[model samples]
Target: MKITRKDFLRLSGLSFLAGGAMEAARAIAGRSSAATESQSTPVAQSVRWGMVVDLRRCQKEKGCTACTDACDAAHNVPRLADPQHQVNWIWTQPYETVFPFIQNGYAEQSDAGIPVPLLCNHCASPPCVHVCPTQATWKRADGIVMMDWHRCIGCRYCMAACPYGSRSFNWVDPRPAIAHINPDFPTRSKGVVEKCNFCEERLANGLKPSCVDACPQKALVFGNLADPNSEPRQLLRQRFAVQREPELGTGPSVYYLV
Candidate 1:
């Protein structure tokens, strides 16, 4: 006489089959109730997505390259024989050069001592979004800055607008140089600008970004900044971190641990 949760679900399924008219009426009532609840709940709008990069945990032993590899493979990023022709959608850049001002008198430091992973900062006030003449780049309601390749006129204004040097233009046909390709992520055509999308496709499906999932050391944390309960916001609240070019007032969502 005592039905467990699983047993109750099973019984409910059987009842749907047994009472056809009643089940249909219940379904309609359930839908109406759901609508009522939805209207009363006041749907949450406005999300500020952000990331936290823990430098203390990132000592290069983690082989953070896995994130780079996953992103490159997913996007079908091309490899160039010449460094000038090389294009990186998401890759590591020298920490010293990235923070040259921070270097001060340490210009000759070895690579072993300094390493930084660079990607689209996904600024709250993204300059790329502002400079795009065709409105090719935009920030989504969920706080993701995305690109519309079809609308891009290839003027490279976004590239100039970006202070982080995150945007890359396809000077040549990238498809020919792609060693491997992932069908899930679309590749950009030549004469178009592309950069990190924060794995928007994955985020849309209630999944974490590929880079966050791929990081072995768990250094990168991504979540909604608006929700204080989100992992990223909680991490930021608990940890002392720094944002790249904070004075620029771009309001970068990405944060770094020093």
Candidate 2:
């Protein structure tokens, strides 16, 4: 009689069964328990991970793809020939395009036409997780928005819910497009959604995200936002920073220092 979050998810997923998506419904039901169980454990009460990107440092070298390349190599992201089908975990976009709503006169005057690197914001209140019927995506206690590629039913609810255009769906088998498969990371099959997880696995092993480590200019700063003394927090306090679409109230963990 008490319809919990898990119950709601299962029932919602079952509705898809009426449309002949049996496997998707099963995944939604079967994973709901595990998803509910994980909700509390992985969230660190005091550690909220976040990132700060120094736009000045990042733009020192024009057309740099080191960050993107490192992420792709570490995660085994495919480099498809067709731009439309490319699986992007982290990539660059025009400055104006990145922050269309913000009226930053300083950024417009100084940093115009710069290619800003974009990735998952890992919002504190993630819309993607809420819309997912299968519980394939959820937010960790540490404030990282995570994905369970195996549990994904290709419903693309998460994709639609994400305002940043971060999630990528595998339309074709991704393995062939990867130049060199990383033995450590798993390759995704066609039909699931994938995106940056802020290097969740690497963080567990006491390492920085690949993009942060690979930046020659030391542009990307990763640390705990909850810790006031952390690099990210320190930088945020000392510099002028902005997030993408803050008006939407997603509480994006990623910030850009201009």
Q: Which structure among the candidates has the greatest lDDT?
A: 2
Off by over 4 Å in 1: 1-45, 60-64, 104-113
Candidate 2, 1-258: lDDT as tens digits:
799999999988888666667776887797777767765444446999999999999999788999999999999999999888889999999888887766466658765678999999999778998899877898888888889989999998888999999999998999999999999999999999999999999999999999999999999999999998999999999999999989899889999996
122-149: candidate 1 lDDT, tens digit per residue: 9877899878887689877667789998
User: What overall lDDT, based on C-alpha atoms, would model 2 receive against the true structure?
Assistant: 0.90
Candidate 2: count of backbone clashes, pairs at least 3 residues apart or interchain: 1
Q: Which portions of model 2 miss their true places by more than 4 Å?
A: 1-44, 103-110
TM-scores of the models, in the order given? 0.77, 0.83
Would you give me the overall lDDT of model 1?
A: 0.79
